[model samples]
Target: MTVFAMLGSTQAMYEWAEKNQTVFYTQILSRLMPAPQRDDPDVQVNQVNISHLTNLEAATRIAFALRLGMQAKQELEERREDLL
Candidate 1:
């Protein structure tokens, strides 16, 4: 139960971090691009691209978290088994 709670908390923190990172990236991109009308197809495509990039960035971060979590869990189990 504690492990599950820890996992949930870790994921929640990761989500918050991901959201902040996306906001930072979006701000940077917005500064680089000129403002355009909402009806403009080019502007819409750029917005979609930004969304895709943000998702990709978040996925990369989550993947790293999962890998680290798995590695830590494995090491803990190994140590426990050794102690027993």
Candidate 2:
């Protein structure tokens, strides 16, 4: 429960942080979730490989946000194992 809460809160924070920003999670997730399309011929591959969100501070914050969610998941899994 606690783990879920932390993950939920962190995820919510990320969403909230992006509410006013042009770059949202969907933009990044789309690139990562379906895997890179470097091999595919459909999408136009850019010569310069760079992410939209190129700010260092923003990048670190995003990393921390994801790390928190992962920690939460680990905590929940541990709890589940204990319950069983």
Candidate 3:
């Protein structure tokens, strides 16, 4: 049987999607903005320009970047605690 046939109807697929959907909002994405200039010294400035990307693409990239940053921060903190 076809995938749709197994699922019974398109309505069922739609229902499943709606039920499992996790919406991403601009507000949430804004909170994950790139680091401010304060975090990096003027000598080695880096920048993130998301003006060309769509909302979803920008949000996904920010989320991944934040996750990596958080992981690295946690590891450093843990190592510092261990050394103390």
Worst 10 residues of 2 by lDDT: 45-54
Leading candidate by TM-score: 3
RMSD list, candidates in order: 22.1, 23.1, 15.9
By lDDT, the better pick of 1 and 3 is 3
Tell me the deviation in Å of residue 5 in model 2: 45
TM-score of each: 0.36, 0.36, 0.39
Task: Report the CA-based lDDT of candidate 2 relative to the real structure.
Answer: 0.71
- Tell me how far the alpha carbon of residue 46 in candidate 1 is from the true structure, in angstroms, after superposition: 29
lDDT of 3 by residue, 43-76 (tens): 7755878789999999998899899999999999
After superposing candidate 1 on the true structure, give the runs of residues whose Cα lies further than 4 Å from its correct spot.
1-53
Stretches off by above 4 angstroms in model 2 are: 1-54
Clashing residue pairs in candidate 2 are none
Q: Supply candidate 1's per-residue lDDT for 50.
A: 39
Candidate 2's TM-score: 0.36
> Judged by lDDT relative to the true structure, which candidate is superior, 1 or 2?
1
